[model samples]
Target: MTDIALVRVTFDTAAEADRIARHAIGERLAACVNIDRPCTSIFRWRDVVETAEEVTATFKTTITLASALAERIAALHRYDQPVIESWPVAVDTAVAQWIDDATHA
Candidate 1:
Protein backbone atom coordinates (compact mmCIF):
# COMPACT_ATOMS: atom_id res chain seq x y z
CA MET A 1 0.00 0.00 0.00
CA THR A 2 1.11 3.51 -0.70
CA ASP A 3 0.00 7.01 0.21
CA ILE A 4 -0.84 7.61 -3.39
CA ALA A 5 -4.25 7.75 -5.02
CA LEU A 6 -5.51 7.21 -8.53
CA VAL A 7 -8.54 9.38 -9.21
CA ARG A 8 -10.76 8.81 -12.20
CA VAL A 9 -13.30 11.17 -13.73
CA THR A 10 -15.41 11.13 -16.87
CA PHE A 11 -16.25 14.06 -19.10
CA ASP A 12 -18.66 14.59 -21.94
CA THR A 13 -15.95 15.83 -24.30
CA ALA A 14 -12.21 15.51 -24.82
CA ALA A 15 -11.98 19.27 -24.62
CA GLU A 16 -13.48 19.40 -21.13
CA ALA A 17 -11.23 16.61 -19.92
CA ASP A 18 -8.18 18.41 -21.22
CA ARG A 19 -9.21 21.61 -19.48
CA ILE A 20 -9.43 19.98 -16.07
CA ALA A 21 -6.29 17.96 -16.64
CA ARG A 22 -4.26 21.01 -17.51
CA HIS A 23 -5.48 22.97 -14.50
CA ALA A 24 -4.98 20.11 -12.03
CA ILE A 25 -1.46 19.30 -13.23
CA GLY A 26 -0.40 22.93 -13.62
CA GLU A 27 -1.62 23.75 -10.11
CA ARG A 28 0.25 20.73 -8.68
CA LEU A 29 -3.05 19.28 -7.48
CA ALA A 30 -2.19 16.22 -9.55
CA ALA A 31 1.16 14.78 -10.48
CA CYS A 32 -0.17 13.71 -13.83
CA VAL A 33 -3.40 13.29 -15.78
CA ASN A 34 -4.08 10.77 -18.50
CA ILE A 35 -7.05 11.19 -20.82
CA ASP A 36 -8.16 7.83 -22.12
CA ARG A 37 -9.87 6.96 -25.36
CA PRO A 38 -13.58 7.67 -25.59
CA CYS A 39 -15.99 5.05 -24.32
CA THR A 40 -19.71 4.58 -23.92
CA SER A 41 -21.32 4.97 -20.49
CA ILE A 42 -24.72 3.57 -19.64
CA PHE A 43 -26.42 4.39 -16.36
CA ARG A 44 -29.58 5.64 -14.72
CA TRP A 45 -30.16 9.37 -14.62
CA ARG A 46 -33.52 11.05 -13.78
CA ASP A 47 -35.09 7.60 -13.59
CA VAL A 48 -34.04 6.64 -17.08
CA VAL A 49 -31.13 4.59 -18.33
CA GLU A 50 -29.09 6.85 -20.53
CA THR A 51 -26.12 6.19 -22.75
CA ALA A 52 -23.48 8.64 -23.84
CA GLU A 53 -19.96 8.72 -25.18
CA GLU A 54 -17.58 9.75 -22.46
CA VAL A 55 -13.86 10.31 -22.02
CA THR A 56 -12.02 8.98 -19.01
CA ALA A 57 -9.65 11.22 -17.10
CA THR A 58 -7.18 9.62 -14.73
CA PHE A 59 -5.31 11.67 -12.14
CA LYS A 60 -2.27 10.69 -10.11
CA THR A 61 -1.92 12.43 -6.78
CA THR A 62 -1.27 11.82 -3.11
CA ILE A 63 -4.03 10.66 -0.78
CA THR A 64 -3.72 13.90 1.15
CA LEU A 65 -4.47 15.88 -1.95
CA ALA A 66 -7.22 13.65 -3.27
CA SER A 67 -10.22 15.39 -1.69
CA ALA A 68 -9.09 18.86 -2.62
CA LEU A 69 -8.36 17.67 -6.11
CA ALA A 70 -11.82 16.18 -6.45
CA GLU A 71 -13.46 19.32 -5.10
CA ARG A 72 -11.50 21.47 -7.47
CA ILE A 73 -12.54 19.28 -10.36
CA ALA A 74 -16.16 19.38 -9.32
CA ALA A 75 -16.05 23.15 -9.20
CA LEU A 76 -14.88 23.29 -12.78
CA HIS A 77 -17.00 20.44 -14.04
CA ARG A 78 -20.02 21.28 -16.18
CA TYR A 79 -22.25 18.38 -15.27
CA ASP A 80 -24.82 18.76 -12.53
CA GLN A 81 -23.06 15.84 -10.92
CA PRO A 82 -19.69 14.63 -12.13
CA VAL A 83 -18.19 11.25 -11.46
CA ILE A 84 -15.13 11.62 -9.29
CA GLU A 85 -13.70 8.52 -7.74
CA SER A 86 -10.39 7.85 -5.99
CA TRP A 87 -8.68 4.74 -4.76
CA PRO A 88 -5.41 3.95 -3.05
CA VAL A 89 -2.72 2.70 -5.40
CA ALA A 90 -0.27 -0.09 -4.73
CA VAL A 91 2.83 1.60 -6.02
CA ASP A 92 6.50 0.82 -5.98
CA THR A 93 8.53 2.51 -3.25
CA ALA A 94 10.13 5.01 -5.61
CA VAL A 95 6.91 5.76 -7.37
CA ALA A 96 5.08 6.34 -4.11
CA GLN A 97 7.78 8.71 -3.00
CA TRP A 98 7.62 10.51 -6.29
CA ILE A 99 3.84 10.95 -5.96
CA ASP A 100 4.17 12.31 -2.43
CA ASP A 101 6.92 14.72 -3.39
CA ALA A 102 5.27 15.91 -6.57
CA THR A 103 1.81 16.47 -5.06
CA HIS A 104 3.12 18.42 -2.11
CA ALA A 105 2.55 22.16 -2.40
Candidate 2:
Protein backbone atom coordinates (compact mmCIF):
# COMPACT_ATOMS: atom_id res chain seq x y z
CA MET A 1 0.00 0.00 0.00
CA THR A 2 1.06 3.58 -0.65
CA ASP A 3 1.26 6.39 1.85
CA ILE A 4 -1.45 8.25 0.00
CA ALA A 5 -5.17 8.12 -0.60
CA LEU A 6 -7.83 9.49 -2.88
CA VAL A 7 -10.50 11.27 -0.92
CA ARG A 8 -14.09 11.22 -2.14
CA VAL A 9 -16.70 13.67 -0.96
CA THR A 10 -20.05 14.95 -2.12
CA PHE A 11 -21.60 18.40 -1.97
CA ASP A 12 -25.21 19.44 -2.19
CA THR A 13 -24.51 21.83 -5.02
CA ALA A 14 -21.99 22.76 -7.63
CA ALA A 15 -21.30 26.05 -5.90
CA GLU A 16 -20.41 24.29 -2.69
CA ALA A 17 -18.21 21.84 -4.50
CA ASP A 18 -16.45 24.67 -6.31
CA ARG A 19 -15.80 26.48 -3.08
CA ILE A 20 -14.36 23.41 -1.40
CA ALA A 21 -12.23 22.58 -4.41
CA ARG A 22 -10.82 26.08 -4.61
CA HIS A 23 -10.09 26.20 -0.92
CA ALA A 24 -8.35 22.83 -0.90
CA ILE A 25 -6.19 23.57 -3.91
CA GLY A 26 -5.47 27.12 -2.85
CA GLU A 27 -4.35 25.99 0.56
CA ARG A 28 -2.20 23.24 -0.89
CA LEU A 29 -4.25 20.76 1.09
CA ALA A 30 -4.76 18.86 -2.11
CA ALA A 31 -2.92 18.84 -5.38
CA CYS A 32 -6.05 18.47 -7.52
CA VAL A 33 -9.81 17.98 -7.20
CA ASN A 34 -12.09 16.37 -9.73
CA ILE A 35 -15.69 17.50 -9.47
CA ASP A 36 -18.52 15.43 -10.90
CA ARG A 37 -21.73 17.41 -11.07
CA PRO A 38 -25.43 16.62 -10.97
CA CYS A 39 -25.06 13.16 -9.54
CA THR A 40 -28.07 11.54 -7.92
CA SER A 41 -27.40 10.36 -4.41
CA ILE A 42 -29.66 8.14 -2.33
CA PHE A 43 -29.14 7.78 1.37
CA ARG A 44 -30.78 7.74 4.79
CA TRP A 45 -30.77 10.92 6.86
CA ARG A 46 -32.46 11.48 10.20
CA ASP A 47 -34.20 8.15 9.94
CA VAL A 48 -35.63 9.03 6.56
CA VAL A 49 -34.71 8.00 3.06
CA GLU A 50 -33.63 10.91 0.92
CA THR A 51 -32.58 11.43 -2.65
CA ALA A 52 -30.81 14.49 -3.89
CA GLU A 53 -28.80 15.88 -6.74
CA GLU A 54 -25.27 16.42 -5.70
CA VAL A 55 -21.75 17.05 -6.85
CA THR A 56 -18.96 14.60 -6.15
CA ALA A 57 -15.45 15.82 -5.43
CA THR A 58 -12.45 13.54 -5.54
CA PHE A 59 -9.36 14.99 -3.83
CA LYS A 60 -5.86 13.66 -4.26
CA THR A 61 -3.47 14.00 -1.33
CA THR A 62 -1.01 12.16 0.85
CA ILE A 63 -2.23 10.14 3.83
CA THR A 64 -0.22 12.43 6.10
CA LEU A 65 -2.44 15.30 5.00
CA ALA A 66 -5.72 13.39 4.75
CA SER A 67 -6.97 14.30 8.20
CA ALA A 68 -6.35 18.01 7.75
CA LEU A 69 -7.82 17.93 4.29
CA ALA A 70 -10.90 16.13 5.53
CA GLU A 71 -11.32 18.69 8.29
CA ARG A 72 -11.03 21.58 5.85
CA ILE A 73 -13.64 20.02 3.62
CA ALA A 74 -16.00 19.43 6.52
CA ALA A 75 -15.64 23.02 7.64
CA LEU A 76 -16.61 24.28 4.21
CA HIS A 77 -19.31 21.75 3.47
CA ARG A 78 -22.90 22.67 4.22
CA TYR A 79 -24.29 19.24 4.93
CA ASP A 80 -24.50 18.18 8.56
CA GLN A 81 -23.33 14.71 7.59
CA PRO A 82 -21.16 15.19 4.58
CA VAL A 83 -19.82 12.18 2.71
CA ILE A 84 -16.09 11.89 3.25
CA GLU A 85 -14.37 8.68 2.19
CA SER A 86 -10.76 7.85 1.45
CA TRP A 87 -9.19 4.88 -0.27
CA PRO A 88 -5.70 3.79 -1.13
CA VAL A 89 -4.34 4.24 -4.63
CA ALA A 90 -2.45 1.32 -6.10
CA VAL A 91 -0.80 1.67 -9.44
CA ASP A 92 2.39 1.43 -11.45
CA THR A 93 5.48 3.56 -10.92
CA ALA A 94 4.51 6.19 -13.47
CA VAL A 95 1.09 6.86 -11.97
CA ALA A 96 2.48 6.80 -8.47
CA GLN A 97 5.10 9.34 -9.39
CA TRP A 98 2.48 11.55 -10.97
CA ILE A 99 0.35 11.46 -7.85
CA ASP A 100 3.33 12.38 -5.69
CA ASP A 101 4.24 15.25 -7.94
CA ALA A 102 0.69 16.57 -8.06
CA THR A 103 0.13 16.31 -4.33
CA HIS A 104 3.40 18.07 -3.59
CA ALA A 105 3.07 20.63 -6.32
Candidate 3:
Protein backbone atom coordinates (compact mmCIF):
# COMPACT_ATOMS: atom_id res chain seq x y z
CA MET A 1 0.00 0.00 0.00
CA THR A 2 1.10 3.53 -0.67
CA ASP A 3 1.08 6.40 1.79
CA ILE A 4 -2.05 7.68 0.08
CA ALA A 5 -5.49 7.34 1.57
CA LEU A 6 -9.05 7.29 0.31
CA VAL A 7 -11.65 9.07 2.41
CA ARG A 8 -15.30 8.30 1.72
CA VAL A 9 -18.18 10.56 2.66
CA THR A 10 -21.90 10.59 1.89
CA PHE A 11 -23.90 13.80 1.65
CA ASP A 12 -27.61 14.29 1.40
CA THR A 13 -27.51 16.23 -1.86
CA ALA A 14 -25.36 16.84 -4.91
CA ALA A 15 -24.85 20.46 -3.94
CA GLU A 16 -23.52 19.53 -0.52
CA ALA A 17 -21.15 16.97 -1.99
CA ASP A 18 -19.78 19.49 -4.46
CA ARG A 19 -19.31 22.07 -1.76
CA ILE A 20 -17.25 19.77 0.42
CA ALA A 21 -15.19 18.58 -2.51
CA ARG A 22 -14.25 22.10 -3.50
CA HIS A 23 -13.51 23.06 0.06
CA ALA A 24 -11.23 20.11 0.72
CA ILE A 25 -9.23 20.65 -2.47
CA GLY A 26 -8.92 24.37 -1.82
CA GLU A 27 -7.67 23.68 1.68
CA ARG A 28 -4.95 21.34 0.34
CA LEU A 29 -6.42 18.62 2.49
CA ALA A 30 -7.20 16.43 -0.48
CA ALA A 31 -5.70 15.81 -3.90
CA CYS A 32 -8.94 14.96 -5.62
CA VAL A 33 -12.54 14.47 -4.62
CA ASN A 34 -14.57 12.32 -7.00
CA ILE A 35 -18.25 13.00 -6.57
CA ASP A 36 -20.02 9.90 -7.76
CA ARG A 37 -23.50 9.59 -9.18
CA PRO A 38 -26.32 9.54 -6.67
CA CYS A 39 -26.84 6.23 -4.93
CA THR A 40 -29.47 4.69 -2.70
CA SER A 41 -28.28 4.06 0.82
CA ILE A 42 -30.01 1.76 3.28
CA PHE A 43 -29.10 1.60 6.90
CA ARG A 44 -30.43 1.73 10.40
CA TRP A 45 -30.45 4.99 12.27
CA ARG A 46 -32.04 5.71 15.66
CA ASP A 47 -33.04 2.06 15.86
CA VAL A 48 -35.04 2.35 12.67
CA VAL A 49 -34.33 1.30 9.12
CA GLU A 50 -33.92 4.19 6.71
CA THR A 51 -33.31 4.60 3.02
CA ALA A 52 -32.24 7.75 1.24
CA GLU A 53 -30.54 9.07 -1.85
CA GLU A 54 -27.01 10.12 -1.05
CA VAL A 55 -24.16 11.58 -3.01
CA THR A 56 -20.96 9.73 -2.32
CA ALA A 57 -17.47 11.14 -2.70
CA THR A 58 -14.04 9.60 -2.58
CA PHE A 59 -11.26 11.94 -1.48
CA LYS A 60 -7.65 11.28 -2.36
CA THR A 61 -5.05 12.47 0.13
CA THR A 62 -2.03 11.46 2.06
CA ILE A 63 -2.84 9.04 4.85
CA THR A 64 -1.49 11.56 7.32
CA LEU A 65 -4.20 14.02 6.38
CA ALA A 66 -7.07 11.54 6.25
CA SER A 67 -8.16 12.13 9.83
CA ALA A 68 -8.10 15.90 9.51
CA LEU A 69 -10.05 15.78 6.24
CA ALA A 70 -12.69 13.52 7.77
CA GLU A 71 -13.04 15.89 10.72
CA ARG A 72 -13.41 18.86 8.41
CA ILE A 73 -16.06 17.10 6.37
CA ALA A 74 -17.98 16.19 9.48
CA ALA A 75 -17.89 19.75 10.74
CA LEU A 76 -19.13 21.18 7.44
CA HIS A 77 -21.79 18.54 6.82
CA ARG A 78 -25.46 19.18 7.43
CA TYR A 79 -26.24 15.73 8.73
CA ASP A 80 -26.26 15.34 12.46
CA GLN A 81 -24.11 12.25 11.96
CA PRO A 82 -22.50 12.21 8.55
CA VAL A 83 -20.97 8.97 7.34
CA ILE A 84 -17.22 9.40 7.00
CA GLU A 85 -14.79 6.55 6.45
CA SER A 86 -11.14 6.35 5.40
CA TRP A 87 -8.30 3.94 4.80
CA PRO A 88 -4.87 3.73 3.23
CA VAL A 89 -4.79 2.41 -0.32
CA ALA A 90 -2.40 0.97 -2.85
CA VAL A 91 -1.44 3.00 -5.90
CA ASP A 92 1.17 3.06 -8.62
CA THR A 93 4.30 5.05 -7.93
CA ALA A 94 3.40 7.93 -10.22
CA VAL A 95 -0.10 8.22 -8.84
CA ALA A 96 1.29 8.13 -5.33
CA GLN A 97 3.68 10.95 -6.15
CA TRP A 98 0.87 13.01 -7.62
CA ILE A 99 -1.26 12.48 -4.52
CA ASP A 100 1.67 13.55 -2.36
CA ASP A 101 2.22 16.76 -4.33
CA ALA A 102 -1.46 17.57 -4.61
CA THR A 103 -2.10 17.33 -0.88
CA HIS A 104 0.85 19.44 0.16
CA ALA A 105 0.05 22.92 1.43
Q: What is the TM-score of each candidate against the true structure?
A: 0.94, 0.85, 0.95
Report model 1's TM-score to 2 decimal places.
0.94
Instruction: Return whichever of 2 and 3 wins on TM-score.
Output: 3
**Whole-model lDDT per candidate:** 0.92, 0.83, 0.92
lDDT of 1 by residue, 1-105 (tens): 566899999999999999999999888899889999999999999999999999999999988899999999999999999989999878888898887777776
Please name the candidate that would achieve the greatest TM-score relative to the true structure.
3
RMSD of 2: 2.0
- Lowest-sum lDDT 10-residue window in model 3: 1-10
Alpha-carbon runs more than 4 Å astray in model 1: none
Give candidate 1's error at residue 38 in angstroms: 0.4
Residue 17, model 1: lDDT of: 99
- TM-score, candidate number 2: 0.85
Q: Is candidate 1 or candidate 2 better by lDDT?
A: 1
